[model samples]
Target: MATTAQPVAAREAVFVARALCKTYRMGEVDVAALRDVNLMLHEREFVVLLGPSGSGKSTLLNILGGLDVATSGALHYRDHDLVAADDAALTLYRRQHVGFVFQFYNLLPSLTAYENVALIAEIAHDPMPPAEALARVGLEARSGHFPSQMSGGEQQRVAIARAIAKRPDVLLCDEPTGALDAATGVRVLDVLETVNRELGTTTLVITHNADIARMAHRSLHMADGRIARELVNSERVPALALSW
Candidate 1:
């Protein structure tokens, strides 16, 4: 199977990984989560990772987001050497350049949607206004609503708004729609698609659903800690038109 593929038009490579490996020590046993993973993510590209549970999808995303470190090989985001970066450097890297969204919406129950996004914007070096962020996700009207007041999909959009509020260079999402139903999931995917298209934020999404890959510019399939195949879509299907 082909392990590497490029986008149609040449773009600046945002992430370059060569022989990247990640291992976790569990008691006396070492378990490899990623093995010799070589990949290049281009600027403003939307890539989907399809794999089963424990297929190193989240591990690779974490490494890219600076939440975890690789055991071996070189990983670079632009000119930043992620493998050689220290804890402080990694922290700065994440703060300045990366935005992350997990399966769960980590919004505070006590805060409204606007407040939740404003919290992140307040600390960022440069950020869009909280209102603007919520508007991007189509939640400007719901800004005053709390998590309990919104549906699952609405909450997820708010989470996305918070991530993008910082205007980070990259957005890393691990199963962003995993918790929602099919219809609601489509709505969340639409927001991600819109963000990637409009903001030109380089996006990587980890999803178990194969249907989600159809909306991406490129799809990567992983198995047993290695990327097994790569597929490039010449034409992208809109997220709303995708059959869930």
Candidate 2:
């Protein structure tokens, strides 16, 4: 069965960042995580943020997901200004618009895959049924299994299912495959690609692996907390097509 495409525009900006800066204080020392970052993420775009450790890729994702507030910058997600948002507004924004996947699966060990996914749907405003979400990640048959009963790749797929089940407008993934071996990592990435293509979630993946950049519609390289370069892939490769 063919999947429908995501709409290109939604009559408003999905993300807008200007002169964004993020700084952290460790005792008397200050660390600049992001500096003078400017970016615009649109609906349904599959973007990859690539950089080494301390390059600020994860910081950018956190700021976008509303998990962390920028120290100095202007960020607008649709009509909501993230910099000006209160804790309650940020919570609602995260609940209603953002879905997150981290390097760790973070699934409950005792809950079956279906139950783990259902937990998110239960709290979501308008979520897809748990079984349907599992099917989307090619995990329907594994729904009955617990996290310990599944392979790392399978567990990550379940995580992906849980994130997408909320029908979020933006999906933020930080080193999503970082814990898996290369082979398993590829499988997890395949699921993420499928989610982006099939569901049209505006997906942003943060990775240090340059190989994964080929799978993105657009790739942004970060350095010293700023976007060093941005490239549009004329021919994007699906994750399944990647070797290594």
Candidate 3:
């Protein structure tokens, strides 16, 4: 992917969603998860999505990462139409291009850190060595440790290494620090910031913590399944400096 800042047009954006809609039907009623959502994520940019519970932040992230299809309107990954993609196409797109980290560490309990990360690298089209990826998150010494043997922050860092081992074009993180304490959460955020800055990966992070917004280039606020507002930081505060 081009690291230099090019003009981000609709066709040129890493991800684009225009008038996107998603609704889930229960036995008798339908719940609208997203409503005419419009969004664009530029290549190599770090953006944070802030919202209350059930504000559709996770839904939007899932759609952007090809993990779920939109109900209606245009959702594009570069020139490809995500809304029109079949399950196979979406799977292919996710496997080949996107990296994901979620709230839980989700590491394989039976595997050591190295093995857990190496599993993805083995299948990636272009992958950094698993060891190198681990080291990127400051986990070189913990390569032999299993998730159960590490602290919460360490496990989260290992999970991050596994996600980025594929050297994906985009990293979609949903509440990556939600499971950790404040100090540990800052550590995870630091690793995320490092990945974005060093590897030039476009990152979209979803978090309920409003204080986390200061670390992002642009903060998007979601409410009732729509993006209610956006705030750009004049100067991004380091994760360690965050009050929360």
Best candidate according to TM-score: 1
Q: Count of backbone clashes for each model? A: 0, 0, 0
Which segments of candidate 1 are over 4 A away from where they belong? 1-9
Q: For candidate 1, write residues 85-144 as lDDT tens digits.
A: 999999999999999999999999999999999999998999999999999999999999
Q: Give residue 23's lDDT in candidate 1 (0 to 100).
A: 92
For candidate 1, what is the total of clashing residue pairs?
0
Model 3 C-alpha lDDT per residue in residues 1-244, reported as the tens digit of each score: 1123333333247877889999999889999999999988887778999999999999999999998988898988888889999999998899888999999988999999999999999999989999999999999999999999999999999999999999998999999999999999998998998998899899999998999888887899999999999987767788778867
**Which run of 10 residues does model 1 get worst, by summed lDDT?**
1-10
What is the lDDT for 83 in model 1? 97
Q: 28-87, model 2: which lDDT tens digit per residue?
A: 999999999999888778889998898999889999999999999899998999999999
In model 3, which runs have C-alpha deviations exceeding 4 angstroms? 1-12
True lDDT of residue 48, candidate 2: 90
Tell me model 1's lDDT, rounded to 2 decimals. Answer: 0.94
Highest lDDT scorer: 1
Residue 239 accuracy (lDDT) in model 3: 79
lDDT of 3: 0.90
